[model samples]
Target: MTVIENIVGRVTVLRGGRYSVEVDVITSSGFGRFAAPVDENPDLYIAEAHRAVSEVDEIIGPELIGFDATEQELIDSYLWEIDGTEDFSHIGANTALAVSVATAKAAASEKNLPLYTYLGGTFTTELPVPILEFASDSEFDYYVMVRDLMEITDVVDAVNGVLSNLKEATVEGYSEATEKASSELGLDVALGLAQKAPMDMEKLLTLVEDNNVAYLKPMGDEELFLELIAGTHGVFIDGEYLFRQKDILDRRYYNALSIKPINLGTLTDLYNLINDAKSERIVPILAEARFESSDEALAHMAVGFRCPAVVLRKDSIAKLNELIRIAEDLGERGRVITFEG
Candidate 1:
């Protein structure tokens, strides 16, 4: 029956001394554990983790005991009811997400199915193309260096050389870097800008045109988003600037949406948002938060949901390695996802 028997949560320390919550969901037939990361003030992250643990021990665990772990949607909805907040403020979003995902993992284990197969059925084989970031001396020179090195040697050595010799350059330089990398690497590579502050419209447009920028995460107003969309040929306006306002997707201002589990509260909520984004013809990108845990469940979710792309940090090796394994397991059935801007 896979009836829930007990639930436990504990504080887990992550890289750079960050704190997160690891949840263990025990059922009649199987068990699952998941660590959902929380990005907070370093001074208060420990307290937040403790609070999430306390919520599981004192509130969520007791309420969810005896429920069927396989009924993922019902259990996830109950998490929201228990929190009694639109934003999961009472129990914390990290706690809700950890419990929701852990329950799914337990059910999948009981059925002896891989997590992606359990969540997405047997036909889920497409893998999202990874957008890797590097800390280089210049924004675009690494692209040129990597391309040239790949021509002389292999990709690994090229990346290694770039990492060993770090330098900085202005974004305005290397206007043709994206085209060169795409041609040389035999894969489409585009520039992604994480715009934190407003810039002059003319200047932003010039940068996009000069650099062949394809993805933009703009922090400006709706006018700026509209300007970029109209001004560029095929630029993808990322919806991450909207943050928690998933409802704003209805406006169709952005061509791509970022899905982060912790921000959305529960697995069902995350799933629903992905579907919603797709309904609007928006490219759904499973993204990593600024401060992430070591959990690889996100990689599974990206595969399960058939996200076209994933915005992952270069140093997030756990997720990267998992994606590699999933690709190998799928063998001939797996292919990298392709989509237009």
Candidate 2:
């Protein structure tokens, strides 16, 4: 009975004056709205937001008006048919993807299930490790945040660790904290970093390898991706990488991939990406979408069940407690919260 009644799409200017589509899917029970993540590449942008909205208004809306939003495959199939491209070209991947996510949300709300509970299901209790991120230096009880930790390390580590002990501890200290916390919990925790931007990938990898750090979310283009892959670093493939060269996904050259739903365009796509990551022995680290609202963050935690870890950026600081609550509600624990002020 909870079918889609109608879908309305709009164009909004996002941060930095980029445009994206925001789509609202109204179902018999409730409505869900999603704003597309900003596209970084202009040359291959998914159709302008206005044009995407126009297609949604004139064509996609009519076909989906009475469709069952919960029938994800059916609805997404229609969306793909409308676009007729793997990346959503004809009808705008951003718009189509937003509708896809909105539809999933609406359906979940209709069932009165928290989005994470729905995506992760009722009986699944275990959750991924939370990789706490801090934009500044801060201190908190490791016992309060650290819990059971797990890791998969190869033979490469010659040294170890994280921040200059400012936003985070020195990379060596970070690893020690995780090690200490793991000892307390009797769990095996590995340190991860989102700090490859300013560092030399080769040198940084050596640093992390020597120090015993586990992974690096060094986001970059094809060349960087290939470099990370060749170095056998646990690469964190993200939205920008996905948008630019998803073909890289065809080859499982890395050991980990961190993705956000917004970059993926739909709940289904996000789900599939996790599956892909898993199949390739790549640990999926669900990262926050670009400036996503709180609900989207919840959705990430919901699917966090499917990943080994989830990375929360600085924007998630205020909502971290709420996110932890949701994870606990699902019987999932192990939260490492790092933050800055």
Candidate 3:
């Protein structure tokens, strides 16, 4: 007999004669192949996972442990606990995912049928699974660094080196820029300079200064928290100024970014989507979502998203010159603006 751990101890039956249980376990090993071996390790990840499950268990687990797992309302209540909160990293996301799978399995078991039957009676054996080929200059790792980067020079040198290397790796199969001059001439370049590691502002300053680059400013922590709730979009490659747009939903692949004042409707929608995404544990590195404001007046509010961070500016471009000016003026009190918005 399997001696289930105390956390997974009991199940409760609710409506439709279904049952569910809240389970928490300290796994003997970390989950991710990429993140497990980092020098920092998965200490934070595991700790956060444990914390998240524990929080879910403390609330909904006790209430529904002995109740029918198929109680849709009960399940919903469990989901609602973290619905609007952006802090899904440590909540019951993994557990919720497992439970969703379990619910399907249990329903299948009771019906003496396969899991997909609930979706539709027909079962198509094969689905188109995505094959993401991220070719890189070096084998990229997601281990987050705890180091502080403060100088503009360091930022520029590091960003330039990283971008150059990545460009060499990924520029081979690009079909879009095959006719462009530098690209047509076969000069390797980072596609969009998208980075997956920790971003240090000091490093960003350096990159902006060295390259003479202009960029959207990052919303500070306070503004971020607020816009996260209101669902405004805000993000920055190397902060030189703030960017605002009407709506995040309008943002799609390669859509030319427009500088404009974001209105209330778009801001609210952005907030809801981001919160929902966070709750579902679907943090997309290359997507934008809305956030809310933390204060009454949202003058500091903004929008956010992800981009492939290539330094797309050439030395002679006017945009490049503006970026240089801003980078040189770092630490000085002056308003930064770009694109008339």
* Predicted model with the maximum TM-score: 1
Write model 1 residue lDDT over 212-303, tens digit each, in one string.
56676666667777787788777677777764543577435778887778788888999999998999888898887656778888888998
Q: Tens digit of lDDT per residue, candidate 3, span 1-341?
A: 11111223223321223222233321122110000001111232434534545554575345434434334334434544544443223333334433333333343344454332332243212111010112233322111100122222322333334334433333232212221322333332122223334345455334334331222233333333233223322222321112232223222211123221112112223334444433433221212111111111111111122111212112213322323333343334322222110
Q: What TM-score, computed on C-alpha atoms, does each candidate reach?
A: 0.88, 0.69, 0.32
Candidate 3, residue 120: how far the Cα is off, in Å: 5.1
Q: Enumerate clash totals for all models, in the order shown.
A: 3, 13, 47
Model 2 lDDT tens row, 120-173: 676545455555554323321111112333221110111112222223456656
Candidate 1 vs candidate 2: the TM-score winner is 1
lDDT of 3: 0.28
Residue 200, candidate 1: alpha-carbon lDDT:
85
